[model samples]
Target: MTSWRLSRNSVSELRPVLSYPFEAAPEHGELCEVAPGVYWLRMPLPLALDHINLYLLEDEDGWWIIDSGIALGPTEEIWEQIFANQLGDKPVKAVVATHWHPDHTGMAGWLCDRWQVPFYCTQGEYLTGLVYTRATSEHFGWTNEQHQIRAGRGQVGADAARKSMGGAGHITRSLPTSYRRLEEGTRLTINGQRWRVVVGSGHSPEHACLYGESLNVLISGDQVIPRITSNISVSGIEPEGNPLREWLQSHERFLQVLPDDVLVLPAHNLPFYGLHHRLRYLIEHHEDHLLALEEACSDIAQTAVELLPVLFKRELSDSQIGLALGECIAHLNYLYHRGQLERSVDDEGRYRYLAVDDTLPMRLRKRQHQADTELPVQV
Candidate 1:
């Protein structure tokens, strides 16, 4: 149901060119060495985006895993094969999840229990995962109904959304009871090399990306991918939150601090060299969406549901509607928070957004200008 794939609006000729160093990905059960002592492992997901990239960081004593795939039987079996044949007989030292997504953390508990090692992730990611895994099973349907209804879905549409909520194969595994926190600037020494934790939000709270300075490599977990822009949504729990703003700000910060030439190992796509260019593409992609959405809202008040076609022109599956609606609300909330749009609620409780004026906000204008004119940064 989660549409983790790239949206229809993410593609444009203005997108920066990226260079893939690897011609092909390693097979599901095998591992490929991307850098010294850093191994890339691919796993299969049952979603539209069918694969996730996991990494292994070699330590003097043992190996550290970047992420654990979803807790399905086949995924567990894949781990078993890797343990038996691929690990070179080294014991796993620690299990680390880049964020709280099911695809990233579902098998974390199982791995920690098997290896008798500590589980590590940011506190926000760990706590949020507990909330979703513990609470969503029973309340997901009812909660989704209310959320969609408020976004202008009719009873039939809302019912369809409710039916598509939690069932089988949805984040079935719970996280370990405890975990070591990976915060911003946390440095970890592995195999005599240091990897620092770079945390970002919006995609998930405190999503952790690991940076190996000496290797000029980054294990970027869904924050910066080569092919697809990560799905940034305003959750049903926090309707007014400005996650799009947070998502954009996080990318802007990365462009400033991270080096341009880091070979990024993203969770979804292949490893590539173009950190800064890709970051700008992501920022501008959302900016273009915001401008189009603003213009669409100028003529008449529109509900989040009504604006879906403006962002995604392709047909959406029943499972994808929930994800699409949440993303729509995120863009609306971004403009609403910037005072470029005004929101109103009807007696039936449907929310509508209308633009305040034709003039673009100063901040939005400034960001567009910077993206167009700024030269390549050395940092």
Candidate 2:
């Protein structure tokens, strides 16, 4: 058996009402059939998250790959093994990435190069991936420092974080210079089953989830996980972005559009059922966190760094500072935009957030009315 190791902080003790149809996840370099032609593949990640689940959808002439793992020697070795033993001697038709995150698109270029196939992803994801893939330390150092300083960390903290912030070379390896675009509602028939592209946001720009109505399966890439919530962070690319709001809004959109009976194949954790149950849980989870963060900001003005304790209870390492700060800012920006909090700069050149009004927490009730106007369309 291959070791599936995750840091203690990454594991969640709370299991929601979602149902897991599969008894266990596929071991490394192995595939488990999830649907008629969809198979599950897990790859190791040298991070707190530990692993990411990729997918293979079979077609008449070839197979479609979803989400290549991070660019690591072990990951490549596992792919080589799978290519030698699995795939039934069929060629890869295309490499589809749900988003631009390194763990999802890290090996995409290499895979496409190997199979001589086109890389499929949304325009937003593709462009964003290119920016990150070619980003130098200087590109991030100045902007990231400014971002951190505005988040309430002083120069000292900013310098420390800048030094710890590794370049993109550590995560993403390469990307195809040219590629195919996956637009919203785009349908592709594979093995007589139609899969529609369901675009989502907040976690990443234009994240795509594939929903197959006939198969009753959804390939949700970090959009909806069964146990842990996806990281909705404000990055240096968009410092004042209210991604938490967008994240919640996306969940609302999903609840309105997607069916409850589909089996969700997420990028993390085990594949599960009870889509509606999990979606509602995810919305409530963030709402609860927002309320907690709101309450934390009521008494005294708090910096994003200071408010990190309210969201994450564990001790954070230096390498995790960037993500932690980004998530902290996301929560602050959500409340700030919702009129529940006010932001100001402190004497130390750091941002501080404080509650302003007794307004009710923002609700998604109004979003339902607008859902139909933006229904999925044919590509």
The numbered model that scores best in TM-score is 1
The 10-residue segment of model 2 with minimum total lDDT is 2-11
RMSD of each candidate relative to the true structure: 5.4, 8.9
Candidate 1 residue pairs in backbone clash: none
| Tens digits of lDDT, candidate 1, 1-379 | 1112222323333557789999899998899999999999988988889999999998988999999988765899999999999988689999999998889988999899999999999999998888777663356565566677789987887777555545323665768999999999999999999999998888887999999999999999999998788999976677677889989999989987799999999998799998998998888788878876876777688899889988887998878887788888999999998998899988777888888854545544554565566454331
Best by lDDT: 1
The reply for model 2, stretches above 4 Å from the true place, is 1-15, 164-166, 360-379
Task: Give the TM-score (vs. native) of candidate 1.
Answer: 0.90
Model 1: CA > 4 A from native: 1-13, 140-145, 164-169, 360-379
Residue 308 lDDT in model 2?
90
